[model samples]
Target: MSQVVFELQGKADAIKTESTLSAFIKNYPVLNGYTKRDFNLAPYWKIPTRKKEKISFETINITDSLKNGASFDDVLTSLEKGINRPFKNRKEHVAFCLITKGEKSYLAMTFDHLVFDARNAETFLDIFQEDFKGKKYDGSLNLKEPAHLSMWMEKFKAGQRVNRAFLKMADKIPPRVLPLSSGRKGFKFKILTFSKKESEAIAENAFSQAGYLMLMPYALSASVSAMHEIFAGRGDSGNYVIPVSIDTRKKEEVRRQFFFSNTSFFIFKVEAGLAARFPELLNSVKEQMYSQVKADLPGDICRASLLMRIAPPSILGSLLKIYLKGQIASFSFSYVGETAYESPYFMDNKIINMFHMPRVPVPPGIGIFFQKSKENLNVILSHLDGMLTDEESKKILSLLKSRLGVE
Candidate 1:
């Protein structure tokens, strides 16, 4: 199962936070539900309206912060461990780890990607905060959705369109992708945070280079340019394929759509020969996104995805593997846009900073994510343990930073 994690750093009161979380879960029974499907039947969540209130919350004490006599950063080490810890079972789709380092506190919420997408995870937090503060909020009873068994022709047509898109991709150059090594698999990451001033400067450069209000294209172009070096050096002139994950929920849907994943992928590919040209890549991405959005490709894909509710997760993975020809993409890419949790304080503690650490799935065990908080932008470089060394990761990010006009 894939996982998405959020690391919020600040001071914390564990007892208070735990109580608030417990109350929050009681208000939303879907937290303890599990997805199950009978043979050939549509999957439905087995949510218990009367079950024990149990949550996976662990408090780790860093008695020995050092391993093998090497120094370790408290926050990162804790978060690395927190994100690595999977949910105990499918029914438990979320887990919390609170790490205390003297006065500094780090809270890591590791969520099952099947349970919540990236954007809604922030909304989940925001609502939790509202609950903790004793503020009234909308009821969550409207979150339950239908099996959506109707509209057969619409689904088949949507599937046809999505399949045609994939066929179109395969007709082009074979996607350039690295072989996923078998041994141990885990992610190594690099977080690049731009200061407010630097972020503004990059916004200016984005408008000048990509276009007005085109920050997503600008950031993506920079990352593509950064990764093009590695791809080019590998001596393969294949098309660079990137799947952009995006949220499809409206602002008003937050109250009713917080239970499951509400996201879609935008398939963006550029030929290796043109990947290095900033202007060309930017234009290609913009044009591709425009055409897809205009054609409602993302919406169609989401509608088609309902057909998978009958298949088990294992089968779904197998199908995806066959579709990708043993390679998923050049790499995964996404821009989460601005975070929705704009509160200055969380659980009465001033938030120092926030960043997402998603465990990008294995076939494509690498991802570059961008999100904005306040006026600053945070970029993350995540890849499997052996996919890139520490030096290589920093260098790739450095290249990205330089391309973004940041020192």
Candidate 2:
């Protein structure tokens, strides 16, 4: 809930893109987010009018003239700088950095995850582009909530449901996890973008193999299988506990719930042996998914989260650490399904591609994300630095590519 990223790659005039981006962010919903230490349950934001100079645009020209901009170890080094750089203060929460090489440009936005989730990031882009094209961004930026201070009994019951679910998980052997490397902790990304045909094949395979409307289960199955191979190779064996985050916002809710994070998790426990069999694994994943849906587990999670908001963040953090016993999950997973920023253009630039770089905390320190844009599936593997060996990383990615039924 600290910083999250959204990256845009496309053709645009470097100088023009910078100026346009600066203007776009100036008017975004988040200017400078502040959380006063007054112990308030409901977070308050300082969405003040913007200052052109207070917000800075960092341009890393890979063309080799800029210094901190110039002598970067590589693109990833510069990118990590852009992503992990702490906000100047509570008065600042978002940072935009542009990386240019000859005619290509990559625009990155790092914003406070407390205020924006992955979906919020995409909607941010779409809104900005709409504004750039003279069609004002007409999003329902409704920031009002009931404070959720009432309904004690309901909240208690919701908590009980969530607790029971996790407790059940606790009854099993701890999931296999990759031990944290004591190495310096920056993140590295391996991104694979499938072509239109490959994306089509994945959807078709999802239907044929997992069943109708089961793309997510199919994708999750592939991810579990990918990680299982590495663990199997290492002779590590145990059930895999993966918490899959799903967007809680429905189709109609996107317009109203467009500001904050709207996501919840479906915890899946797959036995190691089951992951080796794709068909059986897909069935198991789907079974867990459907049963959870039938039980409205995600809904209970969303309601339970509101109750959690009353606790001070520090206490909440402590309780989380204690409850999980320092092992959160086998890894993190999510499927954003479709692109929110599906437009073909941004400002006057052609919108070539869009993807998200979401971090997984150190306990897990690994996440597999899937997003579809322009009929292509973008698979993003985000993990902490030094967590996976070079060969292991390549093999995991290869396994994902092969597992997804892509070439």
Candidate 3:
């Protein structure tokens, strides 16, 4: 199984909402299996497979745990503790925790990255809401055949020239590392949310000026460029790469697939000598991103998965560790679109706020996740603890906000 990359939290009215959610879980058996299945990864680095198992919703009452009234932070801390507890080996890959503090209750779900990527998680929430509303789940996920031995071999052979070109390019430019404080131990999480008007303004401006359907990559490119300029000073120049995760579910072949395990990364390179203005930088980002998409980089990357079966597990693990520590500067993931719970109210409780924090690997030590719900945009900045102090995090976020024209 892949690593547990993030945690998701939301609020709902205590008793009725809890009952409804529990019922929803029961009604949608897929959710149960998705949460309960155990991954088998041994013998070799073959594609991980899951075995279904029985798992029930885990509920906790913290009314007595909190001395008087607990603040949101207190509740969050407790929820994190509960959900982050290590799962039993060879057991479930997903877990749910319901925490109650006084009259308010919180729902926290933890997922193994292999089991649920951002798109799958959001789709799960949609199904949960549908089940809660008394709708039947048709279970119409049309998953394509898994990329097995033959498929991977075919793609690998076809992409040999492209892969060789990418290797040559990789050798010339070193991976760009963010200017974060060193000696960080753990991780720090922060969420920056924009008002409906601010989010709308950013979207409208991008569409009106560039005719771009998605504004995230442009905004991200502009922000990263602005931050690099500030940190690198006036005269320094270099090439930098930002690895952006792209969801593949939108592809017709994988449409509505319930399978959650997949890795699709697009590497966008920004050169200091070119595209300084926001608009120019945006065009550059779009061109590079679209170019990679046209090349079917995601499928090509998936083809590389076959190497897991061929290479020695020990060697593969070591190489991956080195890559994570040295070859990646930062990660940017965005889920910018409508979400299931857009009404601000769910199950009779005002859905206060919802956000996700992706795991931040050190050396690079920073991750930016964006989610748009209703008309609001929620941005989460996660960094290795000592890598970025609170003030520094705020500053980076401020730069991003200014770049997005949110301020």
Candidate 4:
């Protein structure tokens, strides 16, 4: 995961301030148990039981260069470049870069997804904020155990049932061919945002008409419309199948253990006919989503993680790769709603804005992430490199903007 956090400061604060951010970074729990790689045991692979010996942390300061009035984009771009470069070693899984220009500063953090998911990442931020405020760190919570083989097999059997149900549903409605971009290679990402007023308006409109408070209906509908427009000339009108990610932190067992990587995917299908109108399409999507949630599809998937303990990594990895390449055309994740960090200031530096973008893997080609901080809504577009030409990417962005009523 990657994030861009802006620090608002004044000239006096900038001149006098020594970073309070470092303390939070240094004091964070090692969480070494979560960093272990899969171990080979002949025909099967097992998750390591032992925690890593050490955790390395580094912070780079670019305040001198940014003093010339660099834009946030410039700082973000630089930080991204640094993140893309190879790390010195395995222990270097987390790092921070600080950029400052007079009173304003930007802090970027890049973390390996193996150690953090979107929800847990927010939890880490809360911990950091508390530490910055001189609050005591809580160490009583225990880390969740990784799913074992028995747990996975049970869930796998349940997931099989869910898949069977999904297959039956697909037969009733002809599956839509998602107009996915072909011949994509590396990954690429883009970010778009809506102001507090605009985000509120969009949420209000969606809720009033569709009885849905989330902006996903609007976002998904817009994406479907845009893809349909892009592929209409090609006669590719098929049903859309989107695998939406569900955060499992709300689960009693998961929450109790402080599970850091608790997430599951549920397939959301919408007929091509309903894709034209926002409200109807939103309702259709919402119904399917709610049905799966009620059925505990995400929980089943979470339990299925036990497969890691029973299956050989090579075979399991290949199967998953094939599924990602052929089954789904797009993915969506939302981190909208309330956040724990309420204050705009962290230590002496004011926070200008903060947003996170999950890394997108290939085969699906495109990922859309939505995060709401206070009233501001941020949209992150991550896709495989070469998935869409420059013009195609921009056109899709324009379509989403229009759909969301964002200028």
Candidate 5:
């Protein structure tokens, strides 16, 4: 019942530019949605005991001797290095890394999946920046001990609808081994930009025919179908499993008076017969998206029954650890909404980029496409080691554009 939780804290040394910092904070979702009790999913709901450690400035030992730049690669490397250390303090927190790398002049916070949704991650950054400047965060957020898994287990055993759905789904899913390698396996994340003009054109085309705005899920599914045709030689017609997260926080809130999130898998079938017509592919995706948005897990127990077979935290941790070093489910895709709650300000810096991770290492591949503007779209692709080549990806991208008649 304990959710997996990871905590790493550190501060970047660059003098705080309130403008730059504020812009970054605004890029995340939690600030608007968060309340005093809106803890990061992991910190609040994880099933394990919590842990904490305090390290002084000198202990972090980060130096600018090597090189410095705002390159995303460098930032990612630094964050990864800090998170490699095991958590020593297990009491008050069964997790790890409290004040992970404090006084380093940069703060890095990483959360385990059991908690911390897209919104929570953003809120944590907002709190971290405010705390760094010695400003009071009126939100009243705090480091909380993990919730008792036993309580969840009790409810789960009692046949709560969600738990029953999970149990049923777990029973039908055969053991699945993903083709995509975990992020820790040295998978580099690449940022692909789509202009607002281009996305609008695509969405317009889809809506003209389908009568609905094109969503990330639809774009993502189209991208996957195209990739499969290019790389796998297009003869395969079977269904490819794509995991989409359903924010079950509403259900959890009813029971515990707080938000609890659950992820469920959806099957996206490929029809090789329509290989020439990519628009139809996107149309198929829209249909699925429309149905999935309202499809309640509890009501459709048969489909739910099939998905639950994938191990929950306790089992996934063990099986995924060997092939992957850290974090399982690295390569998966979803579309979380993007919009600023209020105007963002930092030390005269404007926020230009917004990035969120896709479920890492979900067999075939994982791609997360997000709406960056009314028309612009941003997609982050995480592929398994040497699976989908650059040429392959490009072909898929072209298919999406040409088929959709996007600019």
Candidate 6:
């Protein structure tokens, strides 16, 4: 249980290999198409400071720990202990616990909410491991410049008609829906495993029938639907919003090195009847998802930054919050899907669980986290301890199985 600390003089080759950010962007289209200019959603440069300190430990070598059934816990503890100025940095950055199990060495990297979102995390891990073999870093620091917020603003200024339409749509949304909570909460982890065969089928059904090549959103929808059934049958208050994290990095943006991530709320407006007609419910879910994306598209956000006209960081943050709350849809799930998970080494401990902080006032929220192994999918839910009893959580999980038909 003792901790060892050391200074890591990263080899140029290793650093290059470790720099898997480019690979991450390539894997997830959701992340690839952004320029640094689109970072208005989540401004990394505007932050008061850049925290680049690293913490390293070498104790109970990873291989030994895994043999003793203490592998994951050791890595988790290190991550929980890592610290920085933001206070939440420990929970916001990815940590790698490299293990050398003879001929099979792997690294485990757990991403914090601050940078890598759920979907991007998985992509990062794969690229990370692939690059860790000491290959030359294929990425160029000379990436394209990010889209300037000012440019986007000019476009919007010339088009007030679009603004009016957006405002009109905003008026239709219900007020007092939900707000992100600023409360301190602990996360619980659950590991759900599926064999390769089962996972392939699930992916096939999701892509072929549902038209979603990625499993994260599909799984998220099913998870939300599950929670909905749980609350509805019990007659407990049933309002929920799904928070989806959006990456503001543009494809041609050089500042992709910077973190400018933002989260968008997706409302799951679940009704008891929708559950009865699963396909119709799914279509409604899909349509609503598209509309939410269209409503607050990244280009539009860049325009928003330009309209504000060189506003102070603090002011911009306030305006962003108001805009997010007003424009984001209502629902019970939060998604953070665009960030990287490059580990320092291969044979790293694979992350098996994740729980997103839920919006305040509401009793339940869900987040999806998957990893490089792809052998596990973690569905994290947070609710009033008393409101969502054990039985209720189990029931919700059961519903998820029936709906997704995952074996």
Best model per TM-score:
1
Question: In order, what lDDT does every prediction score?
Answer: 0.75, 0.73, 0.57, 0.57, 0.41, 0.42
Candidate 3: residue 135 Cα off by (Å): 2.1
Estimate, for each residue in 1-407, the C-alpha lDDT of model 4 and write its tens digit: 54445445643232222345444444444433233344442121222445433333334444546356555556556655644555455544555555655466655566666556665666666556677677765556664453354444577787686556455445333344434555333445666768878888778766776565555656666666766565554566456667676553442333344324556677777676776777788778778778877987777666654555445546644554344434444344444344434567655666666676555654465667776666677777766556566676677777877876665
| Model 4 whole-model lDDT (C-alpha atoms) | 0.57
- Writing each residue's lDDT as its tens digit, candidate 1 over 23-125 gives 6877666777887765559787888778547677877655543554223355566666667766777677778877766555667678877667777787788
- Candidate 4 at 2: error in angstroms? 3.5
Please provide, for model 5 over 1-407, each residue's C-alpha lDDT reduced to its tens digit, 9 standing for 90 to 100.
11111122334223333333444444333322322223333222332222112221112233443455234444444444433333333211112111212222333333444335544444444454455456645543333443333344434433354344333333122322234434454343444557767767766765666565455545565565555555347333233344454332332222231122334444443344543465676667666656644655333433323232333435543443332333233225555444221123221222333444333533435454443422345655555445566676566567655555663
Model 3 regions lying over 4 Å from their true place: 1-85, 98-105, 141-147, 151-153, 158-162, 171-173, 179-185, 229-238, 248-255, 273-277, 310-326, 340-345, 350-352, 361-363
lDDT of 2 by residue, 159-241 (tens): 78878887776634457888777647567777777888888998999899888878899999999999998877777646788
Total residue pair clashes for candidate 6: 37
Q: Which stretches of candidate 5 lie over 4 Å from their true place?
A: 1-109, 127-184, 234-237, 246-266, 292-295, 298-331, 340-343, 346-348, 362-365, 371-376, 401-407
Q: What ranges in model 2 sit over 4 Å off?
A: 1-11, 37-42, 46-52, 64-77, 183-185, 248-252, 314-325
Clashing pairs in 4: 8-350, 176-238, 176-239, 177-238, 186-385
Q: What's each prediction's TM-score? A: 0.90, 0.89, 0.74, 0.77, 0.56, 0.56
After superposition on all CA atoms, what RMSD does each candidate show versus the true structure?
2.9, 3.6, 5.7, 5.1, 9.8, 9.0
Q: Name the better of 3 and 5 by TM-score.
A: 3
Backbone clash count for every predicted candidate, in the order shown: 0, 1, 0, 5, 47, 37
The global Cα lDDT (0 to 1) of model 5 is 0.41
Model 3 Cα lDDT, one tens digit per residue, 1-407 = 11211222344444565466555555333333322212432222123244233343465565544465656556645554543356664334556666666666666566656556655665566566666667655767643343354565676664573455355435344554555565334456666778888988888877775676767676667567555644465333456556676553443323256446544777676765553566677778888778878877766666665656544546644553354444545444443344433334444455655656566544466677677665677877766656555677777788888777777
